[model samples]
Target: MTRRSITFRLLRALLVLLALTVTALLTASFWQQRERVSTAELVERAKAHDVRIVRDSWGVPHIFGAKDSDVAFGIGYAHAEDDYATIQDVTLAIRGRLAMSKGSEAAPGDYVVSLLNIWPSVEQRYLRDLPEDVRAVMEAYADGVNLYGAEHPDQVAPSALPFTGQDVAAGFLFKMPFFYGLDKTLKQVFEGKAELVKTPTGSNGVAVAPVRSSDGATRLLVNSHQPYTGAVAWYEAVLESDEGWHVAGGFFPGSPFMLHGHNEHLGWANTVNAPDLVDVYQLTINPDNPDQYRLDGQWRDLEQSTAWLWVKLWGPLLLPVPQTVYRSEHGPVLRTEQGDFAIRYAGMDEIRGGLQVYRLNKARNLQEWQAAMALQAVPALNYIYADERGNIGYVYNGMFPDRQAGSDWRGTLPGDRSELIWTGYLPPERTPQLWNPPSGLVFNANATPFHASEPQDDLQPADFAPSMGMQTNMTNRAQRLQETYGADRSISRDEFRTYKYDLTYSERSALVATVQQMLALDAQDDAVLQAAQAQLQQWDQRSDRPNRIGALAVLAAMPVVRASEQQLPAVDLRESLLKAAANLQQHFGRLDPEWGEVNRIMRGKEDLAIDGSYDTLRSVWGEEQPDGRLKAVAGDTYILFVEWDKQGHLSSDSIHQFGSATLDPASPHYADQLPLFVEKKTKPVWFTEAQLAGHIEREYRPGEVTLGK
Candidate 1:
């Protein structure tokens, strides 16, 4: 062929070859996309078991199956059916993928996950540290969540499908730290107040034995105050397996095990305890390079990772965002405007938290429970334990760090001093705990663990080193419990419940103290203030539902009490009182209105008066509304009263602030528990097969329950 003809032919052949290559690439991509499992297939696999979920009147699920894994699988499906969005959100948050789904608003959380080194711990220890049975249960749970995601394509976030067993483990690793106040510690570092890494918010838990109970039996009040609705809010479930897995208690959306509650042989409760489990070290950054930090007078490279977050700016569309996270030998490196700091927290290297909780669920007696506690996988919280044997106990529990014996650990430690770094945790036996106190009573109101029981039987601070960063503060709840329960050797069932629901703060309460100080203010200041003083003087210290003066007093004191400022002026207390009075007068034309008139619990179309106040037994949290009313948000989410007879037979009751179906307001179960919750009443908890049989409104396995179009 001529040269020109050959060139044209060569060009045509080259074009043909490129077209074939493009076709092959397109085919491969299409096949890869098709190979990814669909939602329906995942759902089908999830329903592969003969598991059954029975719902009671309040919509609480009582799951049953032939095996523990099957029961967990059912629980996953059931929980997903009610609150799949939250479950997905929690898992994604733990995986540091929330920003990918939620956008920039979730970037901080993603940053936190990376900064905390959540996944590294899990990846390093999840398999070796987690028990096989517990891993199976977690896998089943992941299967349930994946199955639900498969079946509900419309509800699933884009790129969030096919969850695996690791995702389940990651959830626990991601969330367990927050429960113990790791989030607050991170906040301290971010805000450049690293020295303020104190114990988290307080909580109350009491387990009374037969000798302490009027009915000659055991009673437990599982009262945990958390954000009313979220990943941390109380969600109740009863899991049963022929392999001996039976537990009923409040669990977060993504947890495979009950965080706190009862099994057949024993029951337990958790109160937020403040043991200093986390410490911050100000790293000496290399002036020559920002990426290297000095430790032991030698420069060390910082481990760096990019955190990709998806920020949801509008609706379905999400923008991919990335942030840098660093880690040093001290732990997660946090670079703030002030300087580079590293956080060393208890449980940072542990990943058996879920396994420990699962073992606790399967624990048959005090010994078994203690064995689980010995795992020390959980970094914080005080546990109140009681069993059918009438035994009662309390553990001011945490994986406490073994800091330098004489170092002042409460303040920021020097990053360059390698000796200051805690290398290991104090063994569980060495941790502060009390078992069967002579008084036959065990209680913890987020107070110092050294004072968890009767003064005679309480753990002494001298027993623990000051370097452990143990909390020394006592909340009003602890003070009241001591006055009420500690004063009485025997407590009646009604009285026990009454004390748990107490709305009146003691005369020496923090709120009362603030009010008293406010009343001591000079009245000659201003006209608006003098009228406010008149209202403050008439105030009674009761936070009861209809107390009028409570509104003004509480409103005024809220600012000073909840302030994050490093130093608050004493005069600000008086100012808050005056402002509170003005707020009440401006809104209601009078300083005194029933507390119920000022504080309400509203959801959808339902509005009702709520009882309780900050630190009261009835614990109600309210936020100011646009109309000047305080609306309840957290506090008093789910309340449980567990009772066991002399023969070890169990009967319990519970109530939730909201109904079981968190998603569908149209469902009858949506608000069924609210009235009972507000009335301080509880619906019977169906634990046994016979009990569940009688109360079950409907029973079905996964895929059996229809989602109507």
Candidate 2:
């Protein structure tokens, strides 16, 4: 071969070698970077602190540590072991990165996150609004979650790694409003559609003072409902630290601190409260300049930014999707066919409710709890609290905007008026709250705060401002509570427990109303209809399993009754009844099938018959199967009964619809609680370490969490 050709060939070979070298170096650097930021390293650091988690026979974690932050770390680690996917999903959603993993379906959620400016606000307020101690707890929690992802690398999404304290903070800030129906409002804005038939989200929180309890013991029932498993499903844990953090109750996926449960001294429960905390301002925009909006008689520039969403195109391939977000003098702005509207919400700038919850958790008494609540970091909820001191209080808690009183606050306001933009909140005093009522009790089943107590001690509705948007709607559970307790001045412990699990639909309930409507219909000409009406009339308003009439009653009344309660009644109750009767007969080959045969509770490998209807005290709302039978989806998940004896000794009993290991089928806890839940039973909370000793399934530190053989 010629020397010139050989030289040329040699040079080309040299060039190819150089390119390969560079590529190898780049790949090595990427791997090194990932290794440098190893989340498992964070877990090792957490283990340096003294934290021990003891999983009881039921798979519930009883976490003990030297410090509160250590306990939080342990709880995070334990929760990840049970439901890592959900926890990761929650963090992904909060970071506006869910679209990157979940694709097109989750893009809307990412858009809303960016439109509402959640992460931006978190970034701005994380170090500013959140207290240092709260930040430490959240950081430890993030570290624990990251460690789990690091160890179980195959289980995590491609982009999710090294979860940060900011993720924990943002998760709390973003998901907190969902319990209060913020998602429903967002759906109205984005989809331009409202739910036709609305049923109240169920949570029955009742507190009875010592004076009202026959044995002079204070009792509180904490029953909050969510789907069987999801972002908001409850996971029970008992967290304790030598530094005085001892709490036992249920918490959501990403929350480091307990959501609703009790410390040794006192405990509280939360029910969703929807006051007018959000306002949409219709802005006058200049067509020529899209960035300009009118405010206070002058055209002003909108604060604009582009949020780049990394949408998943294929596996590991992300495509950039950019959306322009705008902010006006009022708040976050969105443009739609309706108009340019700005949403000014209470939690738009706040990211410190987690700290408030922590403070409430460590509270020792009613006064201490009240002091923590006065922070008002949480925008809205109904807080039902009880203490060892035999004091019970109910607060229709919300951040009441100090908006101008003369205008209709419930509807859209003009953005041009600067006064319409509320800059402050109503102080704690102005918010509707009752200390210890003369009736010695208070309850909220998503009902009006004005009727929280007995008639004599109930707050006068006329006294509060219309701008607060306090609901006047009553539910079957609320009416049942009132009639049960109001009938007698003092209630025994058994009665308190019995009433909580009562399966009777109240007389004032829409179920009764809808049934009455159906019975009143003229069916003289239709023999089939007469037979159905007669069966319905004999229902006895009971929802027990073997009751033949209840199956038909629940099927016929649930849809129409829920609608009637929400002011969206069915077109015809008689039509619904006829369809229900036909469905029942087709499925069971009889009009009067056993209630259990129709209504079932299905989980994992077990599908068992369940008793209860939508609005009954032992509420169970189920979805229909292909064969026309109903399978319970929601209504009751976690139920807790807290009682303090006359001598101030506290004992609590709790149960979950499913076991502690959320989605793990191999885990023994997956369905352990189902039988107890169906039979209306509760296991002891087992708060003290000594109480948990004999039941220990496994004990370990954060990285070392293991399932028992």
Candidate 3:
């Protein structure tokens, strides 16, 4: 062969070899995503669990079994039936493998999973610390999900199968810290930002004793505001087992226990509580060795590991990217452009959060419930309780760190001091809590725990150490609750429900202050601004659907409110007013459009007016849209009202922003509750068999789902 031909042939051969290597890598990645377990095996596992799933007319699952584990199995299968995709996503997120499916957008979450040492910690404590029964329930729930995945493989990710009990517990471990805004702190560190801002989102929990009720009935409002969809959204279900684990309430996608709702004798509501549960320490790195940080005047080696993130690049291709994870004596270490900082958060190395919830689910009374609370496994939340015995209580629940009293807990501390690193939590009895108050009412709206009840019954901030870092801010909902429920001496059932759906802002509300600021602006040449000011002056401070000026006032204040909540620079009143007025006129041809026209709750083929505004008791937080309407995104999602009469007979009602079939648009129950939810109405919760007798739409065992029921 000629020399030129020989060189060309060699080059061609090299190109072919490169193509073959690429194909082999792609094939290997694709194979990794394939399902390995057989459907028949999953079916056999399902058959082993003796559980019954009964779907009510509204498509809510009432799970029944001989044991709690069996009921948990039913819960898993039923929830998966409604939102299997979300469960798969939750699993992926907990596993720190979200980037494998969602691409680069989820890599940060994957990195956090490694940085926190979620898997290793879970593996260490899953069996050693969790009770045998709890582990069984978790494993059974996983088996139930596995069964569903195996049978309906098309509904889930190919690789999202064979879930285990460890995954369930890890989900709790991964998500608990973020409840108190740990993610925001991490984001600030990642972006090299200074300081952390505690902003109010939404949640309202209230408990009324018989003395406070007009008809001598104990009442509880289990209202938690979460995004209308995704991992944190509430899924409603009623679980019953022969082993005395009967309860009805909300469950997250992967959870087998009720996060909040009523058991046979009592019930509680959960609201997100912000406490100084997380501490960030600035590390002093050694000049000679980058891997060593100064602590206690000596160099300590930082623990290091590689986080191998399987990120999806495109179709059937995963890029393995390795990043270094570091840990100091304080806790997880984050190396940023600013410096290396260590985070020691509550619930760190704790895997008993799910166990705590499980114990709470089975607790029969206040004493048993308090024992569960003593676990201190759940990092943070405010729990408002009511029971069948006309008792009510409020617990501003958190695993508050026992830190040195002098240091600023809200700010970053020096890493060199070992004493600043808190190693234990205060006992639950010392937690800011109230029981059967003289005022007969307890409530929280993501507000100051010190003001949860009537002034006489409220906890004094002075009694607690300043190192606890309790929130001092009060929301409009909290102020309104004081004006409505707190002011009323004898609140009737109608009034209790009315107070929950209250659409009026308190006179002292920030919205009113913002409106006053807008009215004070110099609208010298701007006619729209002048008109908006005139509208605001005549406003009733109510976000009712029929109110015309309410739309203008809310829209004008939203920019400032959003900026304040996000810790961004303050928005100018003149600018906000002029922009809001102009946008309203453009969309509706008038500045005085009805609040209904602006605030909306829309679902598949259904668009309806929703009454409520930011921080109101009705609590509708909306997103601005191109059509000039505000679409309800969060606030007032899963609301439950439980009441026990003088005879101790329990009756409850609930409403969901969306219905039971959370993900399937084709399901009739998808948006069935939206209209009622918007109208401030509710459906009866069929807690007992007698109540559910005529409400059954379908019934079946796991792995034996009958079609066209």
Candidate 4:
């Protein structure tokens, strides 16, 4: 054949080959799509477990089963029925895939998760690190969530599918770090700055022994200030199994066990402690090779990983956003405009937090509880424990780092020096703890752990090193707690409850000091300013209902306190004060209005003034709306007070800012607890099987219960 004729014939053959290849690609794509797990299959798997969930009048589920796994499965299904959206979000967040489910708005969160090496840590440690029983329970819980998503296809995201045991473990690995302020450290490094500032967010916990109570019963207050709604909001449940799994208290959306609450034998509470668990190190990059960083004066290549985040923009469309994350011998690497920094955070390589918590829930005595705490997997929190045996204890627990004995480790450290890097944590026993103090009372309002108990019974700060980064500042709540409970040698059950619900700040509180200073300001021709001063002068220092002076003080101080760490501008403070006065006048037609009238807890069609303020005994704080009203956001969500008699009998009561059903507005439980919460009342929390039976509204296993009144 001629050369031209051969070329034309070859081109024709190539076209045919291309057409066949396209057809094959299309066929494969279709097959892959069809192979994806369907909602029906997932639902069936979820229902395979024999777990029963009983709901009470308040919509709190009491899960029962023959095995621990069964109880976890039921708990997951019940929680999903109430808040599948949040559960989905939390799971996605843990997997570092939130951007895929929530869109670009979630990209930053995904980046942080990847930068923290969340999944790698879980993958490397999950199977071996998790106890056998705990793994079973977590797997069962994952199955239940997957089943719920399967049964309700419309509720599940497209790419999201049947979760596995690993997903459950990831949840703990991803969330626990943030509990101890690791997120704040990452944010600081990501912003290309280094400065340690005290945080305003905090929680309160207090435990009184029988000696301190007139009723001869030990009391433990579980008051954790968290966001009013969303993943961290409180959901009350009682998990029971003939196999010895029994608990009642608050848990987050996807948690398998009660995070803080009481069992038949004892009860406990947790307050966020800001002991420094994270350290940032400035790496010294080799001049000749940019990828190499010096550690211990030796240059080493940094381990790098590329993260692909599915940023959902709108509808089914998504963009794959890529981020370069690095890791080194220290920990996760953070890239910023200033340079690269490595973070060494507590529990970065630990995967036993859930196991430890599970053990704590099942502990029958103080010894067992102490053993659970010895796991040292939990990074930071002040735990207050009380038992029916009239035992009360407080522990400033954390996986504190054993840094170089004599080094300035509090601020940024030189990454080049491996000596400054820590690979393990101090044993739990070495951490500060006080058991059965002579004072008969212990408390921590997110303050320094050294002052957790009465003066003579408190822990000695000198015992711990400065490298531990223990907090030194006393919060207003801590001061108020000392002023009210510290002076009293003994307290009555009634007095204990009343003290926990105290809504007044001490006259000498920092907030009070600031208010007094503002009131002392010299008055100019600004009528609004003069009116505000007059209102402040008449204040009673109480955040109670119908107290008009609180509005003026809170409004004036909001802007000043909300300002950045930089010093507040004098002109801005004056402007804010005048504006606040105008707002008060415009809203109430006077410069003074009841504190309750200005602040409120609003949900659905219900809106009412709430009696509380930040740092008050009954603390509540939030953002203001355009209509000149404060909308509750955080400060008071789930509260539990457990009292155990000398006879080892357990009884408790709890209140949630909002009711148990987090999603359905039509459910009777949607806002049933709001009135009690606003009124500072609590309903009895029943743990006994008989008590649960008496309050049962419905009982069934997952995929069996019908959703309706």
Worst 10 residues of 1 by lDDT: 193-202
RMSD of each: 7.0, 6.6, 3.5, 5.9
Query: What TM-score, over all chains together, does every model reach?
Result: 0.91, 0.92, 0.95, 0.92
Per-residue lDDT of 454-573 in model 3, one digit per residue for the tens? 998889998998988999988898999899999998999999998999999888988888888888888888777778888899999999999999988998897787677567778888
| lDDT (C-alpha, whole model) for all candidates | 0.79, 0.83, 0.89, 0.81
Which residue runs does candidate 2 get wrong by more than 4 Å?
Answer: 1-37, 196-200, 564-570, 705-709
**Model number with the top lDDT:** 3
For model 1, how does the per-residue alpha-carbon lDDT over 1-709 read when each residue is reduced to its tens digit? 8999999999999997676556545544443354364655675667556688898867899899999889988888899989999888887787877765566777888778777777777788778888788888888988888877767777876556666677778877777777777887788778854343222254668888898887788988888887767778778899989999999988888877888889988989898866788888999989899999998889999998887665554544444456888989888887889888899888776778888888899998888899989988888888998888999999888888887787768778889988888789887778888999878888888777876778888888887878677887667788888878788887998888888887776786667777777777777857777777677788777788878788888888656654522133333876677777777878888888899988898776789998888777788888888778988888777778888887888888888888888877888877777887888888888888887766768887776653321
Winner by TM-score between candidate 4 and candidate 1 = 4
**lDDT, residue 276, candidate 2:** 79
Ranking by TM-score: 3, 2, 4, 1
* Clashes by residue pair, model 2: none
C-alpha RMSD (angstroms) for model 1:
7.0
lDDT of 4 by residue, 1-709 (tens): 9999999999999997676556545544443364254655665566557877888888888898899888999888888889989888887887777876677788999888888777887888988899889999898988888777766778877555667777777777788878887877787778854443333367889998988877778889999998877778888899988889899998887779788998888888999887888888988888898788998778999998899886665544455667888888898887678888999988886778888899999999899999999988788888999998999998988889988787777788888887788877887768988999988999989888888878888889889878788886677778888877777777877778788878776776666766777877778876767877887888888888788888887777655654422233433556767888888888778887778888999888889889888767688976878888888888978899898876767788889888988999998888899999999999988777787767888887677643211
Better of 2 and 3 by lDDT: 3
